[model samples]
Target: MANVLIIGAGGVGQVVAHKCAQVPEVFEKITLASRTKSKCDKIAEMLPRKIDTAQVDADHVGEMVALIEKVKPDMVINVALPYQDLHIMDACLETGVHYLDTANYEPPEEAKFEYKWQWAYHEKFEKAGLMALLGSGFDPGVTSVFTAYAKKHHFDRIKTLDILDCNAGDHGLPFATNFNPEINIREITANGRYWENGEWVTTKPMEEKRVFDFPEGIGEKDIYLLYHEELESLSKHLPEIERARFWMTFSPNYLKHLEVLQNVGMTSIEPIEFQGQEIAPIQFLKALLPDPASLGPLTKGKTCIGNIIRGSKDGQEKIYYVYNICDHQECYKEVQSQAISYTTGVPAMIGAKMMLEGKWMKPGVWNMEQMDPDPFMADLNQYGLPWQETWLDKPFR
Candidate 1:
């Protein structure tokens, strides 16, 4: 039995709290915290098992340290904003508690996502005898594990990897995001990037597009290339990779709305004087948009996300596709969240469980691929997200 503290009361946090509570043998105590204590209380009320709730300013290391000391949690599951990642890591380091987060760190002033800031903590965590697991969410989380599993069980050398993420869920809203609107818009509006032949290639956002027929009757959707945090770690860990790219599907209506928002500068992260006060346009727009957590009851359809790897095994070239399809209604019925949050939160809980159970315990900063995928893969199936694999004679990219 172990105590776990989750710092985020969003949709993902709700799912993580529920999943962790499901496994009582591993998580004896659970605490949900956020800047707003009421949000934590709302999630805690839905949990079958009792959990503690607190208000914490995750942006302040001292505040987090105080909470960590009070809760005395074995580890901290950070589903908070990407900007707060460093602050939480600092608190974990000071308190000697383990750390895990879904996304990488991004400065609040700049719309950039990279692992360099987190990777800098490698020596600090090692010296402190603490463990920090980065990018344990669906894309960087499950995709990383799928690649590692393929390498261990099927492939000799993985030369090419295409990470395809498709969300067919419809919330019936004409222009709304599946996750945090500010974060989601910033990521999609940025330039697209991919790794090839040992260097990064940049392209205009949504410049490259393709159509793929997703398995299990998900059908074909238009997917666009984007720069994901996983490409960086996957390239470093899986050195044999020659080419790597990430893709996600978007509807034309969504694209149109985004283009209009960008043209009018609503998507801009820059601060502007509004009624003699400086405010970020994107943040203000986010306040006007619907909360992603509320989309659960209205969302329907499914999501397909996986990795397609091509390389040689046993002296012959081969290709494999591994992916999971999650339904929005099903996730809502189980945990009151859409598949996007469900996909991410499920892995966050599993990663934390692995650490607490000593299945992935180590003293250093690491990515999901650095750990053994066996336990994680098994938990994925046992949890809400079940995945399948297929052998392809030709590459999808």
Candidate 2:
């Protein structure tokens, strides 16, 4: 049993709180904190058991440190924004507590996100006898674990990897992002990148396009190539991987709205003077968009996110595929959130459990692939995001 302090009250944070509360044996006490305590309190009302809520600005190391001292939690689960990752990590280091986050850190002034920033803390964490886990979300979380699992059981050497993330749910809105609008828009508008022959290849936003037939009745959807942070860690950790790419599905309507928003400068991250004040257009746009939490009950259909890996086994070339299919309505029924939050949040809970249970505790910063995939994989099946595997005859084009 352990006490946990969760420092985000968005859709993902709600799912993490609910999932954590379900396993009282592992998460004995949970304190959900966010910038707005009301949001945390709202999520707390939905949980099976009562959890304490607090208001803390995770952007400030002082506020985070104070909260940790007050809560005295064994670990802090960060479902907060990517920009706050380091601040929370700093607090953990100061308080001598374990730390975990679903995404790597990215600078608030820049659109780029990578693992280099967080990876630098390994030496400090090791010296402090504290462990920090990064990128425990779905793609970075489950997808990275899937790669490690394949390398362990299915493949002796991994040659190529294509991570396909398809969210086919319809929220019935003209234009809305499944996650944070600013973060989502920044990632989509940024240049696309992939690794090949020990180098990175960059392309225009939404430049690379491919069609894939997803399993479990999701059918065919268009997937676009984008540089997700997982590719960086996977390539470094698995040196044998020659090529690794990440792809996501997007509808034409969504693309059209994004195009219009770009044309009007609504998606720009640069601050513009407005009424004697400066605000980024993207931030203003995020304010106009629907809160992602409200989309849970409105979303329908299913999501299929997994990896199509090509590698070798027993001196013979083979193709392997592993993925999980989650339904939006079903997730809402259980956790009051869509599959997007549920998928990301469930892995986060399991990751925290892995650390609390001492199955993955270590005195250093680590990625999902660096840990043993067996116990985490088993917990996935026992948890909400159950996965499936199949051997493919043809490679993903």
Candidate 3:
């Protein structure tokens, strides 16, 4: 059993709290905190079991450190924004607590989402004998584990990896992001990139597109290449992979609204003079959009995210695809959240379990694939997100 202090009360955070509460034997105590205390209290009220609530600005290291010192949790689960990752990690280190997060750290001024900033703390965490598990969400989390599971059980040598994320759900809104609008828009508008041979190949945003026949009836949707943080970690950990790419599907209506926003400068991150104050256009636009948490009840359909790995098993080339399909309504009925948050939150909770249970505990900064995947794969079936795998004779692309 462990006392977990979870920061951030967004959709993903709410799901994490609910899932963790479900497994009382593992999570003995839960404390949910965010900048908005009411949001934390709201989530705590929804759960049958009691969960402590607090208000702390995750961007401030002093406040986070104070909270850690007060609660002194065994670990901290960071579901806050990517910008606050380093601060939370610092707090964890100072208080002698382990750390885990769904996303990697990105500097506030730029939109880059690489793992270098977090990976730099490997030695410090190792010296302190504290473990930090990075990127425990859907694409970076489950997809990484799926690759490792494939490598251990299905392949002798892996050559290629394609992480496909498809969200076929509709929230009955004209245009709204499934997650944070700022992060979602910033990622899509940035240049598309993929790793091949040895180096990165960059292209115009959404420049390359392919139609993928998704399994479990999600069906043919257009997937576009994007540089996800997992590509860097996978390329480093799985050196045999010659080509690695990340793709996400978007609707035509989303593209149309995105184009209009870009044309009108609503998506730009650069600050502009506005009535004697400087503000980023994208931040302003985020306020005008609907909160992603509100879409839980309205969202309908399913999301299919997985990995397609190709390599040799017995001196002959082979292909395997492992993925999970989540229904939005099903998730809401269970956790009062949509599938996107459920998918990400379930893995976050499971990863925490792996660390707390010592199945994946090691004194260093590590990605999901670096650890043994058997226990995680089993937990996925037990805790909501059951996955399936299939052998492929033909190539996906």
Work out the TM-score per prediction: 0.99, 0.99, 0.99
Candidate 1 — which residues are off by over 4 angstroms?
Answer: none
Query: Residue by residue across 236-271, what tens digits does model 3's lDDT show?
Result: 999899999999999999999999999999999999
- Candidate 3 vs. true structure, TM-score: 0.99
What is the lDDT ranking, best to worst?
Answer: 2, 3, 1
What is the C-alpha local distance difference test score of each model? 0.94, 0.96, 0.95
Q: What TM-score would you give candidate 1 relative to the actual structure?
A: 0.99
**Prediction 2 global C-alpha lDDT:** 0.96
Q: Write model 1 residue lDDT over 148-257, tens digit each, in one string.
A: 99999999999999999999988999888989999999999999999999999999999999999998788999999999999999999888899999999999999999
| C-alpha lDDT (0 to 100) for residue 211 of candidate 1 | 96
For residues 262-377, what per-residue lDDT tens digits would candidate 2 score against the true structure?
99999999999999999999999999999999999999999999999999998999999999999999999999999999999999999999999999999999999999999999
lDDT of 1: 0.94
lDDT of 1 at 134: 97
